[model samples]
Target: MVELVVQKYGGTSLQTTGRMAEAADRIIKETKRGSQVIVVVSAMGRTTDDLTTLAGQVSSCPPAREMDLLLSTGEQVSCALMAMALKAGGVEAEALTGPQAGIITDFSYGDAVIKEVDPEPVRSRLKEGKVVIVSGFQGCPGGHEVATLGRGGSDTTAAVLAGALKADRCEIFTDVDGVYTADPGTITGARKYEQLDYESLSALAELGASVVHPRAAAAAEAWQIPLVVRSSLTEQTGTTILPGTWSSCSFPVIGVTSETGLSSFSLHEGADRREIGREWKNGLCPWKAVQHVKNRLYRIVVRNEEAPHTKSLLSRFGGRPDTGRALVHVIFRSKEGKQKAGSFMRDLPYTQDCFMVETQPHVWSMDVPERHRVNICQALHDRCMEKEAAPISAAH
Candidate 1:
């Protein structure tokens, strides 16, 4: 039986016409290898950002439904161009929108959840020996209305399609070759993993590693589908995420991840934490939820993109806001690793502004100055992570 693979190309991989052509050639090469291929693509380059800017210029507060309709076009444009490129490469291919490909989603306009996938449309195309290229981010909720699956939705799209189709594996092509112990761009001598378990990858993604989206990781894990993170521009084999945790004798703290562009709210004494938490019904979820209310203060961190709405919602409950903060997480694979990292965090030298807390047994989160986040991550990686991860590649 022939292998079936679902490949997802992110925005950077399809940013230019030349890049798109290269991607087409990549697909062509795979088809020649006797693998059935389905392609999922994101908006080319910064097309989504450009469109959002245009929408904001026209209306201060654009309607959610119309905004989604506008953003969905970006993926369509890229998918069609990819099909054209594949044809130019002498391969039979077809372009499809999310709905046309049979992705049914919920009614949420901006961040719709996929309800189910009717795989026949894509399956028939594959049977015809044609590569099926589906627009990644947009799906139809019902009728003719187009709904989008927010940021990193394309990743979610590919994962879901792979699961529904029971493809052999899902290949996510991005700018990076694989998952790293730290952001390769920021930290020197950052080690790259050849393989990881689904739980570790999901933890890293949720802690602000952009190599893969958290939801995509979750979906792939639930379906027990294997995933590979590779670079579209290189021939090197990337990291493969499979079942089971790392059972290595090396350092259990495998990676350190950080998220910036965040704001926090501190509710004062006598404040109803439960009431405020329950009443806050915004699009953004808390990055860090204060598990234990200590003394007079209870705090929550939210993404900066939703800060305005979040601030407005919390103002009613006397929530004081602090902007320009970053969250750094040291992720460990075992209890021993966590213990070592916790000790390092306590000994690390920092000013009074930095606050460290162990939110989970396997993770330690720090609220530090946004400007010093890189330095902090670098310091942690060099001292705690590098010595134990000798087998991994130090090359970016």
Candidate 2:
């Protein structure tokens, strides 16, 4: 039986006609190696953002259903272009929308969850020696009505398809070569990890690492699928994420990351926390409660981009929200990790300016001014990651 390889090309890899041609050539080379290739593609560079801006211009608050309908087209355009590029290269290929490829999801509109995937059609196409080009991030529920997955959902789409099809491997081609110890854009000394465990990668994504989507990591982990994140522009080896166990005390700090575009809100003690939580869940907004003072206040953090919607929801419960905050986190593993994190925070250049500094078992998170996010991240990376003697690995 021929082996199967599932690959996803990010927006940066398909930003232009030349890039798409290059990507097509890359895929053709893989086919020449005798493996069936299934390609998933995101929108062209900034196309999703451009569409969102256009939608906002038409309406202050567009309906979620219509937004999904609008946003899904971006991926469709990419898929069609990629297929055209492949055909022009003398390769057999067919473009498929999410629904056409049999991706079924819930009716959550802007942030739908994939309920199931039917890969029979895709498999049939592959048997015919045709490369299957799939539009990532959007799916149909009940065989009708377009619904889009949340941000970076194309990653999820690729992972799901790989798992369902029982592919040999899943490759995510993006701008960067691989997952770095810290965001390479922020830290000059940040090094790329040759391999990573699913847990660590998922944590990085959830905390603000933009290399791979968190949901995609979770799906890959759940399916026990092997994933390679690599650069499409070069022949870099890239990073591999899979199941593994490690035990080493020499490595503690793995990476440092920050999330900007944040807003903090304080809910009074008498406010219904349950109701507030429910509202966020129902709206599919990402958030976290950072601190809860004894019968005084509850400090909640949410994405600044979602602040307007969050505020509108909070207003119904008489809650006032404040924006313009950011969070920085240091990821480490050690018996005394919390203490080490606290000491590190105290030594920072602007400890006094921090609104809050808290330590979990393996993470140290601090709330700071939005303007200081990048600086804080760089500082943490310099003091922690760059100076560390050993690479990040779990204690045995």
Candidate 3:
């Protein structure tokens, strides 16, 4: 039996016709190596952002269903272009939308969850020696209209397909080489991690690492799928994420991650907590319920990008929004214990301005001004992540 591989290319990897051609060549090269390849692609360049801008121009608060319908077109366009590029390169290829490829998701409009995937069509295409190109980030359920997964959702799409198909590997091609000690774009001396466990990567993603999607990391972990994140434009080995355990001695601080464009919403103590909780649970806006509450106020943190929609949803229940907040998290092995971690946090350059601090077994997070995020990240990296730490062996 031929080996099977599921590969996902990010928007930057397929940004231009020339880049698409390069990706096609990569697929064909894999096929020549005796592996059947299934390709999943995200919208090219800033297509999704452009679509959102278009929607915003039409209405400040567009209906979720209609926005999904409009946004889903971006991936479809990428899929079609990729197929064309593959065909032009003399490879038999066919492009498929998520639904056409048998991805069944929940009816959550703008943030659909993939419940199941029927791999028959993809298998048939493979048997016919045709490379299958799939549109990522969009899906449809039995009776509902088109729906989209949230931002960075293409990663989830690829991982889910890989699991359902039981592929040998899932390769995520991005502009960056791999997961690093910090956002390389912001931190000058950030080092690339050659390998990481699913849990570590998931934490980074949740905290604000753009390289890997949190949901995608979770799905891959649940399915026990092997994941390789590499640069599409370079020959770097990238990083591998799989199930394992590591010693604290070898890996102290995995990375420093910060999220800007964050906003906090608070409801008065007397407000209906039950209704607020229900609305938050059922609402489309992405938010994290903060454990710390002060002065009888219930607080939730949301991405600044989604602040408008989140505020709109919260307004129905009388919640107030506070925009322009930021969070910085320093991630490390939990074995270090909270006391040691708390000490590390205290040692950072500036702590007087930090309004809130949360320390977990493996992560230490603090609330700070959006403007100070980059400086904080750099400071944390210089203080913690830059030092040489013992390497921990991963338990297979």
- C-alpha lDDT score of every prediction, in listed order: 0.86, 0.83, 0.82
Local accuracy of candidate 1 as per-residue lDDT tens digits, 302-354: 77886777677767667776889888889887787878887887777875777
Between candidates 2 and 3, name the one with more favorable TM-score.
2
Clashing pairs in 2: 247-395, 247-396, 248-395, 248-396
Question: In candidate 2, how many Å is residue 363 off?
Answer: 1.6
Q: Compared with the true structure, what per-residue lDDT tens digits does model 3 show for residues 66-88?
A: 99989999999999999998899
**lDDT accuracy of residue 187 in candidate 2:** 74
Q: Number of backbone collisions per candidate, in order?
A: 0, 4, 3
Q: Order the candidates by lDDT, highest first — what do you get? A: 1, 2, 3
TM-score on alpha carbons, each prediction: 0.92, 0.89, 0.87
Q: Write the per-residue lDDT of candidate 2 for residues 130-187, one digit (tens) a residue.
A: 9999999999987578999988999999999999999898999999999987888867
Deviation (Å) of 376 in candidate 3: 0.7
List of clashing residue pairs for candidate 1: none
Which portions of model 2 miss their true places by more than 4 Å?
246-250, 266-286, 292-298, 305-322, 357-361, 387-396
Q: Which pairs in model 3 have colliding backbones? A: 250-390, 250-391, 261-304
